[model samples]
Each structure stands twice: as structure tokens, then as C-alpha cells.
Target chain A: MFYDNEMTLSFRAISSNEAFARVSVAAFALQLDPAVSEITEIKTAVSEAVTNSIIHAYDNGDGIVHIWCGCAGNKLYIEISDNGKGIENIETAMEPLFTTKPEQERSGLGFTIMQSFMNNIEVSSELGRGTKVTMEKSIGE
Target chain B: MSVGFKTLNNCLIVEIDGEIDHHFVDNVKKSIDSQAVQKGYSNIIFDFKNVDFMDSAGIGMIIGRYKFTKKNGGITSVACLSDNLKRIMMVSGLYRIIKIYNTVEEATKAV
Candidate 1:
């Protein structure tokens, strides 16, 4: 089935923009009229993905992060991409409590939270190219 | 990024206001850690009365504090959590380790 509604947002990979990206996705997903819990789930998952891009991608430098959200029927689809240093070991990165920036208080639970909140999540990356994460959740489930 | 700290009898009650995400979870951790560990506090009560929202980053921040307090033989508890915050923490299994009370006073009493 095709998306009944879709929106794309592009912003600088900055820590401050994390909140903007989360709220923007949440607002767009609101079109599905999800429950309060569903809304929070999307907001939290989006925040985690956007934060990872800002922290791991740009590494305090500069880059672009793109977020795309769409809804069809009761399913919400989200994609967050960044053009920066990509993950070396996708499996290791997805492991619970595995964070490269341990000294920075990173619990390495970003992907864990996303997977737990959403129905599905896919992470694709290239060593020197970039990374893209796609996730989806069904409302009222 | 404001956290109000009230120290009472070696217990620190933190009033966490505003939305908590990666944007300010670091500051929250720093502020609470300084007061809990450096100030020699034995119990930490996170008063989430004003916390509007919290993402996974908040969970990480709380875990970091929990670990720090554990090393010092301190107790960690939460109070006044919004429904959203409570659900997020619950799904992350935070309630299993940290006790949640309806009020800061209740948490302190149990401590």
C-alpha cells in the first residue's frame, strides 16, 4: 500500500536540532490520530535516531540529517539518514548497552529503544559513506 | 536545562523541568551527579513534577546516575512522573531497579 501522507525534513546535524526533529516527526505523525502512548513512542524513537546522527555522524563537526515520515492506514513509517562516518559494525552497534561514547554517559540503548517502541527497524550503513535507519509502527496496536 | 536541588538530611530532591532529551540529558547528569556524589548525598529523588517529556536519553541519564549512586551505597527513586515518562521508564525496565513513589516525601520516607 502507498503512503496516504508523507513528509520530509532536512536539517543540520546539530545536537540542538534533535528536539526539532523529534517534535517535527511527532507533529507529522499526529495525522494518524494515534493514542498518546503511540505519539510518545514516535517522539522518543525519533529523538534517539536524530541524536545518534548528530553525535556519531558529524562528531561535533557539520553535516546534514534528513528525516522522512509517512502514514498509510494505521502504519507509520519513518526514515532518518545522515551523510557522515557510518557504522563499522552494525551488529555491535545494535547490541544493548553497547555505546562507543561510554565516557559521555551514552547507554548504547538508542537502537534498543527504537526497536522496542516500533514494530520494525532496519539500519544500513557504509564505512566511509553514511547510515540510514528505517522504522515503522502500527497505531493502536 | 534547569534542575532544582533541595538537600534535606543527605537526600537530594531534584525538580526536573522541561522536556528531557539528548539536548540536555548531559547537563542533567552532570548537575545531579555533582550534588549526589560530590555533595555526599545518600539518597536521590527525581521529582518529575514538571517534566513534560523524556526520551531514551533520559533513561540513559538516569542509569548513569543510578550507577554512580550504587557505588556510593546510595538509593535512587522517582516521584511525580507524568504518564508518558512513567511508560517510557517502565518499558525500559527502570521501575524494576528504581522505586517510584507518588511524591518526593514518600520516596524519602521509604529511603
Candidate 2:
């Protein structure tokens, strides 16, 4: 089924907006009538993706995070993108424990958590250009 | 998020309220660390009964505390985790290093 509904949000890449971003996405996802666990999982995935954009992509203290969410039938789709410093190596960034900012005490589990919660995830990036993460999940499965 | 601290049985009980995320993690960490130092308590038990959400930032904070307590010959444990939080904990392999209890009272007695 094609996505019948969608919403887009763009916010400053700030830590305070992390919770705001996830809550907004989760609210939009309520139309799917997802189970409590399913919604919680979606919220977590949103949080992780937003955190990566704010902390890693815009670590230089400036950038905007864009999120686009769409839903159709029982499936939800999400795309989070940032135009800050792009990832140098997408493969290394996706690894479970490979974090470039170890000094910040990052667990480097952001992508892992997103993958665990969503049905599938894809990442694309270009040096000095930007990074985009797309994730999909089927609810009530 | 709001954090409440108390010293029970020589264990620092850090009760966290509301969402645990990157936005509030630094403040939470500072509060817990300062309380532990002032009270001279090495063992710490996180009370998450009221936590609405958590992410990787919480995991990092927990691991950092685990190392701090372990180096001080103490232990770090969590109490009152929702099933959703437990799922994240499992994915992060945090259960390998710390223990979980049904209540802070049980953790205080054990730690």
C-alpha cells in the first residue's frame, strides 16, 4: 500500500528539541492505532535518530534536522536528515560500538537501537554534504 | 526530568522522574555524581519508576556510573524498569554489567 498520510518537520539541531521531535512523530503515528510497545519503540527510534543529527551531524553548534513521516495501512515510514557535517564512513558509523565521540561518553548504540526497533533501516551520506536515515516499521504484526 | 537522591544502606538511590534523554542527561549525571561524592556512597541504584522514556544517552550515563562505582569497589543497579526500557537495555547489552531489581528496596538490600 502507498503512504496515504504524511507530515514533515524541521527544527533546529538542539538537544532540548530531541524530546519534542519524538513526541510529535509519535503523535502523528497514533493514527495507525499501534500497540503501546509499538509506539514506544517508534518513539525510541525517533529519539535515537534525532540525537544523532543533533550531536554528531551538528556538533559544530549549528544545523537543522528534518523529519518526514508517512503512514499507510499498518506500516510507518520515517526519514531523518541533516545538512551538517556528513558522515565520513556510513559503514563504520552503523557498527554497534564504533563512536567517533568517545570523549562524550556516547554508547554508539543509536543506530543499533533504531535498527532493533524498526523493521528495516537504510543510511546514505556524502562527505561535507549531509546524511539521511530512512526507517520503516509494520505495526500490529 | 527531575532527580531525587537519598542515601540508604550506604547506597545512593537516584530516583529519576520523567524522560531520560540527551537533553537532560548531563544535569542528571551531575546531580547523581555530586550526591554520591558528598554522601561518600559508592554503590548506586537508579530508581526509574517514573521514567517515561530513555535512549542511548541514558545507557552511556549508566555505563559511566557503572565504571565509576566499579572502580570504587561498588556496584550499579537499576530498579523499576518498564518492559520497554528493559528491551532497550537488552539491546544495549547493559544487563551484562549491571543488575536489575523489582524495587529500590531490594536493590538497596542487595547492594
Model 1: runs farther than 4 Å from truth?
B37-39
How well is each residue in A1-141 modelled by candidate 1, as lDDT tens digits? 588999999999888898889889999988888898888888889999999998997786799999898899989999999989999999999998799998887778889889988999999999879999999999987
* Interface RMSD measured for model 2: 0.6
- lDDT tens readout by residue for model 2, A1-141: 468899999999999999899999999999999999988999999999999988888883989999999998889999999997889989889999889988777999999999999999999988788899999999999
What fraction of the native alpha-carbon contacts across the interface, defined at 8 angstroms, is recovered by model 1? Answer: 0.59
Report how closely model 1 matches the true complex, as a DockQ value.
0.67
RMSD of each: 1.8, 1.1
List model 1 lDDT by residue over B4-71, tens digit each.
89976568988888889888886668778887767789788889999878877888888777887788
- How far out, in Å, is residue B51 in model 1? 1.5
Candidate 2 is graded, for docking, as high
- Count: clashes, candidate 2: 0
TM-score of each: 0.93, 0.98
Across all models, the iRMS values in order are 1.3, 0.6
lDDT tens per residue, model 2, B1-111: 689888889999998999999888866787788888889999999999999689999999999899889988999999999998898899999999889899999999996
Candidate maximizing TM-score: 2
